[model samples]
Target: MSYDLLLTGAEQGDVAVRDGLIAAVGPGLPRDARQVVDVSGRLVAPGLIDLHTHVGPGYWSIDPDPIAWFSGVTTWVDAGSAGAYTWGGLRRVATESAVRVPALLNISAVGLAGRTGENRDLANCDTALAIDTIQANRDLFHGIKVRIDAEVVGVNGVEPLRRGLAAAEACKVPVMVHIGAAPPAVDEVLDLLRPGDIVTHCASGIASPLGPAVRSAAERGVLLDLGHGSGGFAFDVLEAQLDAGLRPHTVSTDLHARSVFGPVFDLPTTMAKLLAVGVPLADVLTAVTKNPADALGLPGGTLTVGAPADLAIFEVRAEQFSVTDAHRQTRTSPIRLVNEATYVGGRLLSPRLPAPPAPWVPLTRAQHAALTRRERHIRDLLATPLVDVDGLAEQFPRTKPRSS
Candidate 1:
């Protein structure tokens, strides 16, 4: 009866949202609601949760909220962007950020800041230091992540993973391993991982492909994740596996600056790719929502009453679109899912690329002052209406925001 908002989705009746939670899902939700979002004919589901993202202004990362929320991703997990040495920056973001951001601490001590061989030096796999870091920051970190590519492992091979698994064991959490590059091939990598441990980038195109070992691991309960990053995903790998019924348990874009430009433009784009490649829409939705939340130990990928009102409304367009992968492979599909609106705990967030100017409805002085009081940064940004010279210089040493 009394609620803040009401929403309607395809195959589902009117749903009521009240006090930052799903109040009910049925026909004729009360007309006394404060806001009504008639998303009828579209897909209304819990906000998407990205299991792997390199999110931040820090190294190997990018500003997660703007890129993530625009594409219907509400929760993001940073995969091995920070280690013991560089964990502070990410932790700070997680604490202050409105979106849910849990991370997998890197096994390497220096993190991904340096040139790519983070685990090349065997000494960097400091389980004790990693344990200390996890022990200190229990809220920020949920598990361990290690990239076992030949370049990352160097001569050490699977030792880094062994140590990383030990650290995860020490912290009593899950482990996510990135497979590619060899010496310690796919089978060897899967051998180190436990039942619940995650194997990211599962649709990798390589000589070994998804052999008996990978299928066996999945049969035994290991979670497969389609972490579609650069050189990590391929059309062939995904199609064969799907045809053979080796479906990935979760879908996540290895979202970072590089992948954001193409192949992995955003989460919806990746989901669209799966649908194009023959995955059922419902299964694709589950891969991005519930399955990820369950795997990452996060919350709110459901529309249950009293649950967090983190929801995403998507406009499913039946038109021609192109989906590409890291290997320059493309699959043209007839459907695309575009994000229409995102709700975070029932609060509507303003997007970065806002709608075209709407006659410039001026805000009253009192309203402006109150908004300024609530959001100081927006006030400052609009007041200047240009740039923050000093702040920009501080953040970007390589390129100045201004000539001076």
Candidate 2:
């Protein structure tokens, strides 16, 4: 075959990636391939996209970036680590790395600091702070990230969401809200979200369960994301939602230190779990690739010749594997397969990869110079007086008086 690379396998049939693109895909290859590898038991598919992941400074236990290289995720969106107060450093870290990191600016200025004293005061959610942050580092930031779960928001309820919507509106982008176990009900949160904004952890396993209300939201064009994390996804809720025709528009692993084992081993493992739940293989691929690509406005999830050669090769096996939800309930099935390797722009990476660097190494001088410029602009906005925030308050929903 006259191909640069050739993969022959039962699942793959015959596939070739050449000149950093999928050059050929059929039953046979040309005789002049520069490299040919037999993959008889492995499956071939597009590299994964994780729309929700917790690898960030807040998840201080782990390195925020390189989770993609370790988990077979080619593209990942860091779900809110730095809001207005700290977005500069996070953006700087992302720009200095080779990993592709798109971020959802957290609604809370302090970001995800878990439980008591964690929820930054509502006043800190300055619409001006958010707008200026977005304007200053618009290239790195996308949308707003609000953790609406009860444990994360406490007595404040959906007030944080209101602020997030305001910030998203101010920045002219979508807001991705974390749902499931939120008070005032998921319905209330859904009501506040406009079409095109996102609801993640849609299959949340706890108190504020998902139901027909979610289906209604889906019908109204709200993006439902299955971001199965350590405490979000519930099998019962997910099954019920699916039964009600509220299929998740995107499948993601809200991968973190706590969830990246057995049940949520990696992004591919999460995909396999969704497949076992009656989602077709092609549909699963779409959830992780095309859907997220459209959501994030990125490219390279298809086999279109001339696109970047980012791909994942897997071995769909009959070996038994167990999948567990947030509550530790097991769902063992015998059809899941593991990723064999991943390729980014034609560079293949083994699945048994080690963990990425930690503590976020300092940026190079060139990178430091580039990041400093953006940081200064955001800091300047934060220094602006409260009088300059009237435009933001207008975006907040006006509280209506109760009828007598």
Measured by TM-score, the strongest candidate is 1
* TM, every model: 0.84, 0.78
How well is each residue in 1-404 modelled by candidate 1, as lDDT tens digits? Answer: 57898885545788788888888887766677887777878888798989989874344566766765578888889898899998988888887766778899999988888537899988889999999999998888889999897888888889999999999988899999999878778899997778889999999875235788888889889999999876689889888888778998999999875666565879999998898888888999999988988997787888888878888888889998898888878897679998888887887656663111123323447645754564676656678746556555555557647956
User: Alpha carbon lDDT of residue 232, candidate 1?
Assistant: 80
lDDT, candidate 2, 260-363, per-residue tens: 54346577778767765677878888998889878867776776666667777777777777777777776755577567667776777543333532334333
* C-alpha lDDT score of every prediction, in listed order: 0.82, 0.72
lDDT of 2: 0.72
Residue 120 lDDT, candidate 1, scale 0-100: 90
The reply for model 2, stretches above 4 Å from the true place, is 1-34, 64-70, 96-98, 113-118, 350-404
After TM-score superposition, the amount by which residue 132's alpha carbon in candidate 2 deviates from its true location, in angstroms, is 2.2
| Model 1 TM | 0.84
